[model samples]
Target: MKNLKKYAKAIILLTVIILLVCFSFYKISKSRSSQFFGGLTSHVNTEEKIIALTFDDAPTEYTNEILEILDDKNVKATFFVVGKNFEKYPLEGEAIIENGHEIGNHSYSHQRCIFKSQTFIESEIEKTNTLIHDHGYKGEITFRPPNGKKLFGLPYYLNKNNIKTIMWDVEPDTYVSGDADAIVKYTVENTKPGSIILLHPLNGTAGEADREALPKIIDELKAGGYSFVTVSQLLKYEN
Candidate 1:
């Protein structure tokens, strides 16, 4: 039955090709600043002495401390908060706005953005955006998927709906240990023109370093003549 053997081989080859295409889609979607559809704004390309300080995760108990430091330094930053985290801590989310900072939608559940359905992707972004709005955040709501991952469905929706995907160019806390002084030093040493720095000051004990590093980072950056802007604002200044 040579014909039967040929049919079997054909099936196997088709399967292999299907798997390869799926894997490629996965890789492209999960890229930090890449996509197959719409616009992806990770970091700006500029020589101006401006940078964006973006924080991911909750408006946790440490929100007040961070806001106070930013206030004293006379700098404005952006907070990308999750829908569920905001639901769990509504006051902190509101405080982010009350204290005069930009707010972004991280996701509804802070789940990974790859290998998920279109409905799931839609819910993750839309629900968080709704929640952020409920908390009185009326600014242009940009987005940052959890862990900077996105696949086709997420980007397609974001692009179609005109939502900008934000990522960071410098993340010292994420690379090194999440310690306050350590992160502060790393940020100071690594910051460049038009850099978008991501910080996680909530979600766990690992983020405490960001809390400690926030004030110092602000002071140092100001001293170095770097002004903080929102991710969208930073994009406007791109070269």
Candidate 2:
């Protein structure tokens, strides 16, 4: 009976330790700033009134609409496009380039990168990079993992290849759901100097609020004397 009780306690302690490790990994995978390896930029550390406006999962049919709003505001933004979507919407991808915006790779299949194999990770990024190059994006190709989730394999591959992972400090669409006004308010309120603002204006109906809020967000930020820059340009201001 004594031995059984000791064994039970040992099992409980083991289970608790396992749970803690799992929980810690979960939090780290979802973290915007922390990673197992490589340089991750959630927001550049600077006091300049300049910010990078990044739209993820792009080159969908809504690309033109988003681009139009940015053009109207005379703002330059970065689009992290998925490989398959970019292929399907070649003209839209071309349009993004034509409009003088920067493009980054957002993976080929847009899958969650945690616990994935290194080969799989490399394939996803390389496939997307190839497509981006084929589409004539000449600027530095940065990367943003799908769903902003990454762990050992993804970060290791990125670090090995010297690819900087671009994350965002401000994500209003995610927190505010489909409320345009709320997105605008949250973004405008949370934005600071050197903030990397993320939006998902290409996500079909779910993204309508973001698309609607884009112009307002830009106008509000510009009103506060914040100038927009691309991800590469924003990196230059990092201290």
RMSD of 2: 0.7
Number of backbone-clashing residue pairs for each candidate, in the order shown: 2, 0
lDDT for 21 (candidate 2): 99
Question: Could you tell me every candidate's TM-score relative to the true structure?
Answer: 0.87, 0.98
The lDDT of each candidate is 0.83, 0.93
lDDT of 1 by residue, 10-113 (tens): 99999999999989877776566678777777678888899999888867777777788788888888988888878878888888899889998889887888
Put down candidate 2 lDDT per residue, 1-239, tens digits, no spaces: 99999999999999999999999999999999889998899999998999999999989999989988999999999999999899899999999998999999999999999889998899999999998888887898999999999989999999999999999999986689899999999999999999999998988998999988999999999999999999999999988
Candidate 1, lDDT over the whole model: 0.83
Ten contiguous residues with the weakest lDDT in model 1: 25-34
Task: Record all residue pairs in model 1 with backbone atoms less than 3 Å apart, i.e. clashing.
Answer: 29-150, 29-151
Please identify model 1 stretches exceeding 4 Å from their true place.
Answer: 1-27
